[model samples]
Target: MTASPRTPSAAPKTDTTDATDTTEPAAGTGRKPPRRRKRAALLTMAAVVVAAGTSLAVTRPWNTDHDAVQSGPRDTTTKVERTSLSSGMKISGRLSYDAPTDVIAQGQGMITWLPAPGDTINAGGKLYETDGESVVMFTGGRPLWRELAAGVSNGPDVKQLERNLVVLGYAKGLGLTVDEKFTAATATAVKRWQKATGLTQTGRVPLGRVVMLPQRTVRVQEVPGKLGSAAAVNTVVKVSGTALVAIVQPGEDQLSQFGPGRQVTIRLNGGAEIPGKVRSMTPGSGGNGGDEGIQDKPTVTITLADQDAARTAGQSSVTVTLIGTTVDDALVVPVTALLALDGGGYGVEVVTDGTTRLVRVELGLIANAKVQVTGDIREGDTVVIPE
Candidate 1:
């Protein structure tokens, strides 16, 4: 009990030591730096997340689902014939016929000129009568006996007979040009021509004799007069030929569309449709309705493809057509199936085995709802139209 208390005998010396309570505000020099740093980091992370979300909303980057909104295999077409041929390929081509000869002039004083130069009789055209109208030239139709004697001394009958020789495919023996002068050369060519033509004359061009020429002239004029009345030694009458042609004009826009070697068909003014080809044309097509404010119309010449004596006899006028290029055995399809891709190209959706896949395709030579395509895709594959 109190035994331990006896040790405190001397009153503790009260040493007065000034002691300040060192209770400082937890070393205030050290600030709460870490807590603020952690808060700042948290805030920065949140801001970053927001920015990322906004960027995603604006950009709306690539997405498979969004890629969605998008998108006559009639080959074996023939140009000319609808029915398939056994072997020959069909082509659109024009038909050209030979131009006919014409003879002109009748009851002439002196046969001034002739159309064709050859002496092939009845070559088909008009003939000018050798009535020696002009002293320099002479030519004409076959002369009858009654007029023969009268023409020999009165007109250029002999000269006319000689020139007729030249037109009959006979060579001018005396080198006489068709200037209409009576010459021995004319006699030789005429006689040869007469012999070839089965005429009764000897191998000599005689006065009052008329010979025929092959081929005719497009135009002619007949002179009225009595036989042997021509001023020149001998003169005769009877020239034969006619004039007929049709001119057709195409639209100005159709100029390029028309070309050489193009097939054409026409329905004559009063006849059936006749096939033909482009014979010739004016430099260019005119304006609207084919009128360039000019008196004459710009026209194209068309030669009949086929000839019919009866058909041509009727009053004739015609229409013309110009052909265009075409292809055969071309693999084609409905133009609608061609879908434009987003990347400035073309594509097609192919359906194979119940699955559809889009494939890029290259197109070539598009015409009339049909287009040529080349790619890994083969023909006969079903195509899915893009919705």
Candidate 2:
């Protein structure tokens, strides 16, 4: 037999109850709750929803609303000011003497004496002893290739010898003219120089009697021959200019960025920094075999402004920083003040009075944790940063 569908009955009505009420209806009681209690419960829930929305509005991060003003301490702020900014490129280098040249022995004699490394030799100074005779130092561009005597052909080497004699005060009364000719007066001057230098007065300059270099003073860098060794036609001593210079090999693409007289900074191994300038640049020997795609590197020489300070480091590796393009009298700010906007580009928060607003800026040279900024930003304006 099929069952008949029962009719649904309406729910019992009662007055509204307060949401805070914890009382329950008595067992077997037919009485319904008042409608006021139900209304009160809904009103309480609505109040809670409104309270949560108010909290979110007050605690939002980085409020963009222009009408709102920030309050409390102002420690997270910085000022924009006019300053100079430049980019730098650091290269590894070594501190050492300049123009290292080999002093080769040109005579067939036994080495009697050799100067210790680091010894300074000036014009008219004894470089080393050969067969009980001293080989002197002379300032000239070319070495003495042939024996200089009264019968030798005129050449620049003879003039170099005559000039050295005049500088050493040996040609004061000889009336010797400094020319490419080895005249009789030059022989007399040579004799006087030989007598004063404790050598035989033969009035003739033999090959290997003097070591001609371009500098007025030279520092001995190495002594390759021993005291008792034969002074063969080989490098007896290595010498260099007295001044110290930093040598660096940078890529060929950076050749135009460096030149003579450009200012630079040198950081020594001891963490001390000193000022320097570019002294010279030499093009590198390019080849096709080595690194296929890489170009040859050029050599750069830097001279320190403070020679006394540089001497303290001796021979050691250092860092050479080359200053690149510079922006002078530019509006600058700390790098931390920059903010990346959701839309493309960058901006900084400008704090005026107690309010903050984003000001778009165009970036320039970034150096030393500071950046150059432009576009509507003025010097002395305060900018905000995150703490």
Candidate 3:
């Protein structure tokens, strides 16, 4: 009995498996054991990884500390700057006179003489000759509608004539008062003017003897009348001011961007640039009958600051740049440095002492590839641009 008890047989073989076992079955056995616990553990690990990634993206842990240094190449970074930013658009334009007026020939006569193009006629100067008689220029706001005689009614036309006579030294010693009246003094001054200019010493100015213009001086641009042709009431010549201006026809949407006194730039054909300012804007007829449905545009007039510089270009095509919205003393950075944030905003990578951090910013005028930025940044702070 002692010998039998000495070697207690090993415990009977049992077909039980450990509850926490995860070992795969033997190869080629084709046995697919339940693996729910394994799958659940793997899913839990995946959820943790996803949560960490989300936190990293939203929180931007690298930029959490302001004092941290960022390492980046010096050439890939730019400094925040303070400067003036403006939005502008360039359009084709013509460099020519500011205001062009047609000189119409009144009464009937033979056009014996005509001023050549580019001829500058001043106040009281001869404009043309009809029937071998000089047609003089008069500086007045209104045209001479009737013959200037002693019995004519008092009006601004008489006052304009008196003023011209006074300016031209014809009213000297005549005690002429520049009022809206054709008195004896005015008639006497007219006679003096006529005698000095080789005209008949008539105390009245004939209707066809004078042409009124607003400007004191004008440059003749064209002569529609030919010598020896019979002159009927028609446009005899075209004239404009001596000063040059740039004319641009912009879209209707651009009307608000231009106005009187707004500064602009005029680029000449030779690549020279000059400063200018808007002088006036005229509502255009938009598309004409022959335009085939072209859009309507407004005509903008710009005056050059330097008339001498513009005269060098003469009547030629030019480039006009209109400055629209502008911001002064703006903190700016390269547009390429902006980063799209996760929660719908923009940010920039600010680098300081070899460390970089994300900085939230508010955007403003974007011009010439430079963006206006305002945030927790200084003018000299370095911002990294993605390579």
Candidate 4:
């Protein structure tokens, strides 16, 4: 007999039965589906889904296609080279005496006589007269702060006294050990020093009895103490080096570019260029000791490598050129060739054998319209630049 076609209403019950057959039983029931799906069928479904997605993405059938826009030859180009690059700034300076150093009084007495401003005081010589007595300078590694007499504490002050006595010819037969401790021989040497300096011959060396300096001699700049004034721990005189120096007041940022012994070119106001080196630097308010921040540049003292040239140049305003930054044997290109990359940072467009590529580079100092670069670039490589 022929079977009658199933009515549409039977479809719902058939679908429900098929769904129940496919679904697994609830948890803890331990009941599995009536029929297991074929492993090949599940794998095939997953692969087909992935393939369909990939095809849609690759084809993008709904979108319209346009002609590719080709990049033409650059309007300008440059060759990368290995060379030294540096950034520099021209700084104004002047040939002037360094700041006056205060000759502070070390002892207490009446100021009897002062040295003339133009006088020069040598080491181991008298600095000034106090109450008709000389406050003499003696060679000492340390400054004398207390009485160098017997029963005094052992310190460098006592050693300085003993050394001074030996040099001054007081310890002839005493055989004093120039150590940091006081001995009877040291006291005897002090007595001899007191007698020579026209004192009461007390076997005690008092503080402020002498002034010590690192140099051999100093040119007297000024004598501020007046005759008959009480000699205390005040600045008695002002002095400076006899040699001329170029003073450069560079701002804080530029100071980093300079250091002791760095070479420099000094252009005097009278139109002369001299080779010099940075001798020293003092960080503070350059003038008047005001509250001017970095604007008040530190005073940099530059000494001419040639002493005769410095003397000839004389004291005047000058311009100094200092080396600020330097990179040697570096890959470099024109500043214009540096390009802002689409992702970030910087890059250059390199043209090699008619083929063009973008190369990222690390940038360094920019000097004289050229920039230092490093990276996938090589020397003699042609790079594209804007006109």
Question: Each prediction's Cα lDDT score?
Answer: 0.39, 0.73, 0.73, 0.64
Off by over 4 Å in 1: 1-165, 169-249, 262-277, 283-298, 302-329, 351-356, 384-387
Which prediction has more favorable lDDT, 1 or 4? 4
TM-score order, best first, reads 3, 2, 4, 1
Q: What is the lDDT of residue 216 in candidate 2?
A: 90
Evaluated against the true structure, the overall lDDT of model 2 is 0.73
- Could you tell me the lDDT of residue 119 within candidate 4? 82
In model 2, which range of ten residues has the least summed lDDT?
Answer: 52-61
Models, CA RMSD each: 31.2, 20.7, 19.6, 22.0
- What is the C-alpha lDDT profile of model 3 across 136-242, one tens digit per residue? 99898888888989999989989989999999999999899999999999999999999988899999998879999999999999999898887768888899999
* lDDT value, candidate 1, whole model: 0.39
The stretch of ten residues in a row with the least summed lDDT in candidate 3 is 1-10
> Model 1 Cα displacement at 148 (Å)?
20
Error of 3 at 170 (Å): 0.9
lDDT tens digits, residues 160-217, model 1?
Answer: 5545556656874467566445455555665565555445545543433333433243
Off by over 4 Å in 3: 1-86, 286-290, 323-344, 348-359, 373-387
Per model, state how many residue pairs clash.
56, 13, 7, 2
- TM-score-wise, the better of 2 and 4 is 2
Model 1 per-residue lDDT at 20: 26
